[model samples]
Every structure is written in C-alpha cells, then in structure tokens.
Target: MNGRSFSSSVRVGNWNEDVSLDEDLLKDFLEKREKGELLVQRSSNLNKNVLQKAELSISKDGFLHFGEMVMLLNPENSEQSLSNPSPVYGNYTLSVNPDESAIHVKSHLTAPCGVSASSNVKPCGRNAFIITSVDGSEPGEPLCYGQNFALRTTEEFMGHLYLTSDRKSFLKSSKKSHLQEVSLTDQDSFETCWQVVYMDPQLRLEHEGLPIPANTKVLIIHSKTNQCLAVLRKYILWTLFGKECEITAHTYLNGHRVEENENHWIIVTGNPSDDINTMFDRPKPLSEDINGS
Candidate 1:
C-alpha cells in the first residue's frame, strides 16, 4: 500500500492541551508585561493638541512642507562599508541640539585654527541639523525648489540654533577646497540662510513653484557662501549620542576634484499619524482567539 503525505496544517491532536507553559515561564512573561517589555499593541500618549498641530502640518500630497519636522539624510553615508562598519544604514539622521559644546572633533585638538574659543560662539563644525523654511510660510505650505530655508536644531532652551557658513570658516586644505567648518548660531542672519536646489538641473523649470517630494535627493546651497552643503564622510565626530558624520559647505569643481555625491541629501519625513500615535498610545489587549474564530 502507498503511504499518504499529510499537509503541515493537518491537526492530528490537541496540541494546546498537550503542551503547557511552566510556572517560572508564566511569571517571567507577566513581569515583562508589567514592565511594558512585551511585544504588544499600545496606544499613543501624545497630547491631542500636539497631534492636531502635526496633522495640520502635513501636506495632502505627502510632499515635504514648511514647518514640518524633517531629517536630512546623506545618501553617500546611507550604506555600510568596511570604513563605515556601523549597521545603522539609513538610520544616521541629521540631528542638532542646543548644547553646541557637545561636538568633539579629533583634529581640533592639534590643528591651529583661527576659530574663536568664546563660550558664546558655536562653530557649525560637524554639528547636527533640522530643516525648516526661513520664508515664514505656513506649516502646511509645500517646499518649493529654490526656496530659502534654515537648518536648525530643535533646542529652544537658550535659543534656536541655525547652521551657518561664512567666509571666515572657509578652508583650503591639501586635499581640496571647501568650507572647513559649518557652525551653529542662535542669531538668524543671512549667513544662516540656505537654498534648496534640484539635483538634476534639468528638473528646475519643470518643478518650478511645485512642492518638493519627500525622500527625493536634492542639493542644499548656502546662500551666503554659494557652496553646496556636504557631508564629510571621513571626518567623524563624537557627540553625546556617540560618533556621527561631519557636515560642511563646499563648492565641487573639476579643478578641485571634490566628489559631487557629498552634496546630495534626501529629505525624510514621517507620517503625522504614525509618529503621533507611537508617542502617546496605551497597550492593547491580546486577542481571545489565537486563530480567527
């Protein structure tokens, strides 16, 4: 007689009844649940008013809009390599804080720099950043190409931090010509202003007056220096959050031979509902039936 094959889903006996969880296992599970360590659905804890504001800030088409919380992503550093062994591919977002002193550079200790050591002065040397419109447009207004904006830190305790590039910070090293340091300042000045430019120059006329799509690569130019904002992949700095890539403003030229990819950045934005819900939700109970009833 030929043997018959059974499907994996075929239930021959009461598996649930045959196996049982032990007392220690049950106790551990309960403890984890009580500590909110269990893998379970939870409700959001964000204030209703804040959630409403965030919802209003998001554009209908989901394009990057003014006043929206945005993170600038460097595409060149988005991948893991032998040099960049960190598994945080695409996770190293551009972030900034009020405490500008938190940035510690390895080269600053030895290099004879003209930068001032005043406590009041903060150099944009490899500091974190956040994107916002400088035009004073409404939060829901879409960011258009060639629009002016500021890269600011979320910290407002002392004052708003703006990413600034000026002629004084310009450097000409043996390797290339670029802005040596991008500093942070509490004051809003012309030096802190930057403009968004299309990565492909051909797209300029087509996308004029149109909203910039989220997650698309673009170039940011410092309005004052006329140099493109770039990430110094080789220059890593230590921050309170650990090691992070450095940022600078550089004009890439055929003569200078600077890599153009350094200037490319992607604007990343989160869904308003998801971000709000995750911050302020309550835990949801498990379903009564393991299998659909």
Candidate 2:
C-alpha cells in the first residue's frame, strides 16, 4: 500500500450514472420531476367529468316522455298532424293494459268548440292506444280503443311488439311474411314479432328485415318505403285560430345516445308492489299466448 500511494493522490467518484457528468443537467431533471413536466402527469382528458342531458325515459306507470313532451292520444282522435299545436299534442297519461299487453295513451285535452268527438267520453275525448295491426309484417295503424288495445311483447329489453285485433293475433314479419295478420294460434305466427333495436341511444322498431323510421308526422313509417302510417290526426278544432291546431308527439327517436337506453325497456305500473310475473302474465294471455295461442 505504501509503494502504490507513495505520492498520496485522491480521486472523486460520480454517483449519477445516467447524467452526462454535468451537475446542471441533473438539477434540470430533478426540477422537471417536481414540476410534473418530465414524467406522465395526470391526464385530464382521460379523466374528464362529462355531464349528460335528460333524454327519453319511461316511468314505472308506463308514462313515456322526451324531456317535457308526453306521448298520448290526440284530443280530436286523429292519426296525423299537419300544422300548428301538433308538437305539444299527445295523451297526458299512458298506462299498460294488463288484460291486453298494449299501451293505452289517454288524453284529457278538450276538442274544438264545434268539432265533434268521435270516441265516447265524459266531457273529455276518447282514449287512443299505441297498437299495431294484426300482423306486424305490414306497418300497423294506431287505432282508437275504448278500454285499451292489445299489445304483446315477445322478449325483454330488445324485443318485438304485436298488435292483436281479438287478442288472438299479432302484426309480425314485415316484408318476408308479406305482413299478414296471422293468428298467434299458428306456430308460424311467432315470426310476426318486430325487433326493438336501440342504436346510438335512439329507439327503432325493426320487423324481420324492415326498419321503422321515426318521424314527427308518424312514430314509424307504414313500410320501409317511408309511407306515412294512416290514422286520424286528432286536434282540438277550437274556434280560436291558435286553438284549432293539432297536438302530436314531436320526438320519436333519441336525439342523444345511451349505453342501454334503447336496448332496455321495463314494464311500468302504478302499483309498486305488483309482481313482475303477474303484471306481464295475465290469466287470459299466456307468455306464449301470442295471437291468442
């Protein structure tokens, strides 16, 4: 040891192996870490708080609303709306008919001063229902009913709706089956059901290969060709120029997208304690009781 270090020389060792032997560079690196500039900072874009707007929602009481507009029967019992007052026209309340699996859209609005009421009413106009024809294969019509119209669902969430005339048949299979009003009693009638598809948060009624496009004039087209479904477009027909307009649903499809909004639909009822099975399964109509099967 004395021979090797006779001159007594000392050397300093560098501890930072990554740095270029510069103190300034090491200082700059440490400063960047403290300021959160060098390492990946928490990205706000990935963790942004986005607010969503209120969209179409069905209540437990079977009341469907798009924002402030409620879907219901026209006071005049008409099928389509042409001019004013149509946007706000609709039944105030819509409930599910346990006896018939269809929805009953009722209106309490008064008719025009001289306009006659076609449906029976107690001062108020008659009630209408959202129903399809016997065989959904063809675009069905929304007709006026007394108690309620018969509508049946083939599945949960993304399912098909069938309109029955005498609680024995449903409108199913748009073009393929030639849109015939086949009786549910027939096994082939099972194919008559329409498909409820929710795409981009918008609800669409599709039958076999045909799609029901929604428009302000009509909830759906009579066919894929965009023929408007024929119905009595009811209005107040009041003497007042402003009051003579019709009331109809302005929104049919969703303006915004939802993850499961269109794909899912639940049976709504006033009785919160109602059993799901009983609500859906009545004594007259069996689960497979499509078209009165």
**Top candidate, metric TM-score:** 1
TM of each candidate vs. truth: 0.54, 0.20
Per-residue error at 277 for model 2, in Å? 19
- Candidate 1 structure quality by residue, lDDT tens digits, 1-293: 34324432444454343234345578889897786554441111111111122212233585777666555656544333546674323323344421333222211111121111111111122222356767788766777877888876544221346767676432442122244556666677888898877776656668766778876777888898788877655555554334556656775544445336667776655434653421112133366245422
Overall lDDT per candidate, in order of appearance: 0.51, 0.25
Over 4 Å off in model 1, which ranges? 1-59, 77-91, 97-131, 155-158, 169-178, 253-259, 272-293
Candidate with maximal lDDT: 1
For all candidates, the clash counts are 12, 32
How do the residues 1-293 of candidate 2 rate in per-residue lDDT, one tens digit apiece? 23332222333233343234456777888897786555233222111110111122123424322121112212322233344554334322221112111111121111111111122211111112223344432323322111122233222221223322111125432212222221122121323222222232232333223322221112322121222111223333232112322221122333442321111222211223333211222244455457643
lDDT agreement of model 2 with the native = 0.25
